[model samples]
Target: MIRGIRGASTIAYDNPELVMQETKNLMERIIRDNEVLPENVASVIISTTADIVSAFPAKAVRSLPKWEYVPVMCTHEMNVPNGLPLCIRVLVHVNTTVPQNEIKHIYLNEAVKLRPDLTK
Candidate 1:
């Protein structure tokens, strides 16, 4: 079976270092928590708030050891008048036997507020 795990993170500012760091942080948490192997990953879709333009979060995912071949794409999230700013979101599609309810969706930093219901 295949499942898509969702995650999001936020940076204090639009810096390349922050983008790379937080994006990698979020992905690592998802991978470790789900016990997902890079080989089982299909694709990852990443989006950042329009206010962020310093770097592509996909670059961070690609930099992960053993994840060089995972397909990843990056884009800007839709701009809403009162939407959260400086946020990065990701959807990772991977082959897994785990049930949907058991999957861990990571939301870090300020992005945690976006999905309070999913938190423990």
Candidate 2:
């Protein structure tokens, strides 16, 4: 079965360094928490709030060792009047046997507010 692992993180500033760093951090945490191998990943979809334009977060995923071949796409999240700012969100689609409820979704920094119910 294929499952989607969701995660989100907020950047302190709109810079290439912060965007890539925070995204890589979030991706690493997701892999560790879910026990997923880079080979098992199908694709990664990343989106940022309108305020974020300094970099493409997908570059961070490719920078990871063994993650160079993973398919990744980046886009801007729907611009909502009340949407959170400086936020990066990811949906990792992977081939996994684990049940949906068993999967852990991660939220970091201000992005944690996006999914309060998933926080520990």
Candidate 3:
């Protein structure tokens, strides 16, 4: 069966290296916590707020060694009024035998404030 894991994070700046580091950390955490292997990941989709047009958040994740085989894509989030800024969201699709409820999702950095209930 195909299961989905969700995660979100925000960057302090638009620097490529900073974004890459944070994205790597967030993805690694999600994969580890959910017990999902990179080989089992079907694809990863990332979206960043318009304020982060400097670099694609997906680029940061694709550079990771564990994610070498995973297909990754990036896009801009819907510009809803009063939406969070400098945020990058990720949705990972993995082929797994685990139950949906068992999957772990992550929200880190300032993005954690966006979903404090989930973080705890």
The clash count of every prediction, one per candidate, is 0, 0, 0
RMSD for each model, in Å, please? 0.6, 0.6, 1.4
lDDT of 1 by residue, 1-120 (tens): 889999999999999999999999999999999999999999999999999999989999999999989999999999999898999999999999999999999999999899999865
Model 2, span 2-120: residue lDDT tens: 89999999998899999999999999999999998989999999999999999999999999999999999999999999889999999999999999998999999998899999987
In the range 13-86, model 3's lDDT, one tens digit per residue, is 78777778888889889978988777888899998888886767787777777777789999899999988888
* Residue pairs with backbone overlap in model 1: none
Local distance difference test, per candidate? 0.95, 0.95, 0.85
Error of 2 at 79 (Å): 0.4
